[model samples]
Target: MDLLKFITAGSVDDGKSTLIGRLLYDTDSILDDQLEAIQRANRKNDDGTLDLAILTDGLKAEREQGITIDVAYKYFHTEKRKFIIADTPGHIQYTRNMVTGASNADLAIILIDARKGVVEQTRRHSFLVSLLAIPNILVCINKMDMVDYDKAVFDKIQADYERLTKNMNSTQVDYIPVSALKGDNIAMRSPNTPWYDGKPLLEFLETVEVNQQPEVQQARFPVQWVIRPQTAELPDYRGYAGRVVGGSFAVGDRIVALPSGVASTITRIELASESLTTAESGASVIIHLADDIDISRGDMLVKAGEQPVLSQSFESDICWMDTRPLDVNQTYLLQQHGKTTKVKIQDIVYRIDIETLERTASDGFGLNDIGRIQFKCADPLAFDRYAFNKANGGAILIDTRNNLTVAALMISEPVDH
Candidate 1:
């Protein structure tokens, strides 16, 4: 079965954690021992009620504060498909955690409290999802029980949310009414919501076409490691092992190595126990070139004509992950694919306001700030626009002094009309 990776985002106390816990419980995905543990915790904290939120509050700090501070991942599978949930924190202080979780998500679930309707955090998360270019979005209006399960209330919230989404550039958005605390309209549809005819949350998740996004337009394989046997039995064995970031490559396809500008044909593709003729995106394979021409870990292989732009300077939108403010003159190490190079921030173009999506010219960025800026690298880096290919277009900045990942970057060029 195919796997679906999704991230959950919402305001604090919006029932994001409870919704996930209920989904696991209703779908029989939780083990008996795990359920017993949760029951024990619930009984201990009981004031005549079961704290279903305890199911996902795994961290001690989270359990004590009743708020998620970091991304909590959970795995479960139904008959139709498997799921990996990235339960991200909803607080403003933890916005960096949300960005990290949503970076690899194929879908985003933005929940809203029915009683509170659309709040500031709802807009903030929706904007962040749009900024990240998450392909699919599901707007779940939670806590319908608090509103007496009224269809009118659900309709009003839906309308308001639709209006709010008008400013977003999302391709697909869905709305569903649910009560996570009571397990209503989660895995199974609720009879109480007779007026609501949409499928349950789990049903939608199982059937949604999460992989319908466009395929890579260009093939890119960055060499992560090189395998060479020294023994006589396999003395001449040589292969470049890496993951295919974009497009597909076949055994006989002609390819070129970047930076060196050398051409070679793919002789074979090997996996753990078998050899394949072709490799597609997300596949890890060992590629044997027809002629070995000094390829290393940082080198990239691409089709001769479909090569990415090579440059030492480029502009990108960055999400600062560190607590210290970014210094424009400071130098950092940039890691792309398996390649690393020293780079200096040349200029601070503008900082984006998360709430309003407006650009403000600034000298530096603070923690969790998103902005577009230019960088000057020590050597030419091969990349594509983030909108075209996520893997090739994305990079991470690391502080050389502390070896800390400080920011996530998306490469882009100024549009020419």
Candidate 2:
């Protein structure tokens, strides 16, 4: 079965964790030992039902304070498809954790409390989801039990959400009413909402179409490791091993090593011990080149005719993840997959106010801040705009002092300057 990676996001106490727990419990994905442990905890809701939130609120701080502090990942599968659920923190202070968890999500389930309707955190997360360019979005109107499963409440909230996201950059937006605490409209449609006509959350997830790769099919292989084991058994073996992050590659296809601008043909492709005639995206294979051109780690291989922008300067949308305010003077380590380079922040064009979605001049970014930033790299690098190619356009900035990731970057385009 193919895997579906998704995340749950909303304000505090919006039932993000409980919704995940209900999905797992209803799908019979939880292990026997885990169920036993939950029983031992004896956590239950006011309705005397077992508190399913404990399944995802794993941290001690979370259990004691009754709020999620970090991103919690849960795995489960049904006969139709597998799932990786990221139960991200809903508190405003933990917004960075939510960004980290939602980075790789194929779909985002933004939960709304039936009682509270749409709020600031809801707008904040919707903006982030749009900014991240997640393929699909599902707005789960949760906690229907608290509101007596009223159709009007669901309708009002759905209308508000539609207005909120009317100008947002999203490809697909869907809605479903659910009561995670009572397991209604989660695994299957509930009779409680006789007026509502829609598939349950699990069924929708099983059937949703997810674009697995970017639209562009230009092959990109960033060399992660150069294999040159001079052992007698394989004396002449010189292979470049890495995961194909984009497009496809086949034996005899002409390729070019970027930055160096040297060209060669693919002589062979092997995954582990098996020989392959062609390698597609997400495949980790060893590639043999027809000619040696001093290719090394941090260098990228692409089709000879097609080229990604090679430049030292670029514009990007940056989500500042660190508590320390950004210092434009200090240089950082820009890590793009296997490649790393020294980079400095050149300018802050504007900061995005999550509350109003307005752009304002900013001195620098702080924790949970989203802004447009211009940066210059010490060396020219090969990459595509994030909108065009996700595999090549995403990167992270690391503080050289502590090696802490301070920012997540989404490249817009290479700056001519």
Candidate 3:
């Protein structure tokens, strides 16, 4: 079965985790012991109804505070497909956690409380979904039960959201009115909303293709390890081991080693010790180059005609994730597509006002602040624009001093010289 990686995000108490719990519950994907544990937590619920949120709010602090403190991942599958669900936090302070969950997601389900409509967090998340370039967006207008399952309410909120996301870069935007608590429009249709005719969320998830318009990125692989198992019988076993970050690699394909400008053909491809003619994106495989070029960890292999941008400095949009203010004088480490190098923040171009979609002068990015910044890497970075491919363009900034991640970097369009 194919797999889908998705994340759920929204404001605190907007039922993001509960929606996931309801989906898992109605799908019968929960185990007996897990249900028993939830049943025990249900006894503490204010109302007689069970607290389905406990299923995903697994952290003790989350359960105690009734909030999601970190990104909790859950896995389940139906006969149709498998899924990896990332339940992200909703609070503004936890924006870094949300970004981490969204970096590699194929789709996102942004929950909107029916009574509250679109709030600040909703806009921030929608913008991030665009920045992260998540293709499919399912805006779940949740808590319909509290809103009396009113179609008018859903319609109005949908209109407001459309206006808010008019400038976003998301490819597809869809909506559903759901009552995560009552299980309406979750796994099964609800007659309460006779005017609405969309399929249930789970049904949509099962049927819809998350990568609706797949970006055909050029084959790019960053060597993670050099495998040279010197078995006396078959000695020359120098293979470059890494996961395919973009496109596909196949035997006999003309490939180029980046930063060094060495060219060669793929001599062999191995997956789990089995030889293969081709390895697609996200595949973990060992590749052997014909020429035995000077390739090593952090060096990328790509199609000769479709090489990624190689530059020592590039501009990008950055979400400041550190607790302290960004320090321009401090050098940070930039890691992208398995390659790491020391980088310096050269300039802060501007900060974005997500609410107004305005760019204003800014010295440095503060926590949760999105800004355009220039970075000079110690070595050449092979990257694509985030809009072209997320895995190709997404990177993180690490503080060399403490080795803590301080920012999420999404490379913007490269300027032509």
TM of each candidate vs. truth: 0.91, 0.94, 0.92
lDDT of 3 by residue, 58-115 (tens): 5647546756355788888989989999887777888778898888788899999999
lDDT of 2 by residue, 147-232 (tens): 98899999999998888787587558899999999988999999999988989999999999877445668899999999999999
Error of 1 at 368 (Å): 1.1
Question: Candidate 1 residues 348-373, lDDT tens each?
Answer: 88987766667788988998788798
As for TM-score, the candidate ahead, 2 or 3, is: 2
Q: lDDT score of model 3?
A: 0.86
Per-model clash counts, in order, read 0, 0, 0
Using lDDT as the yardstick, the better of models 1 and 2 is 2
TM-score of 2: 0.94
Question: In model 3, which range of ten residues has the least summed lDDT?
Answer: 60-69
In model 2, the runs with Cα more than 4 Å from the true position are 60-70, 212-215
> Which scores higher on TM-score, 1 or 2?
2
lDDT of 2 at 278: 99
- Between the candidate structures 2 and 3, which one is better when assessed by lDDT? 2
| CA shift of 10, model 2, Å | 1.5
Best by lDDT: 2
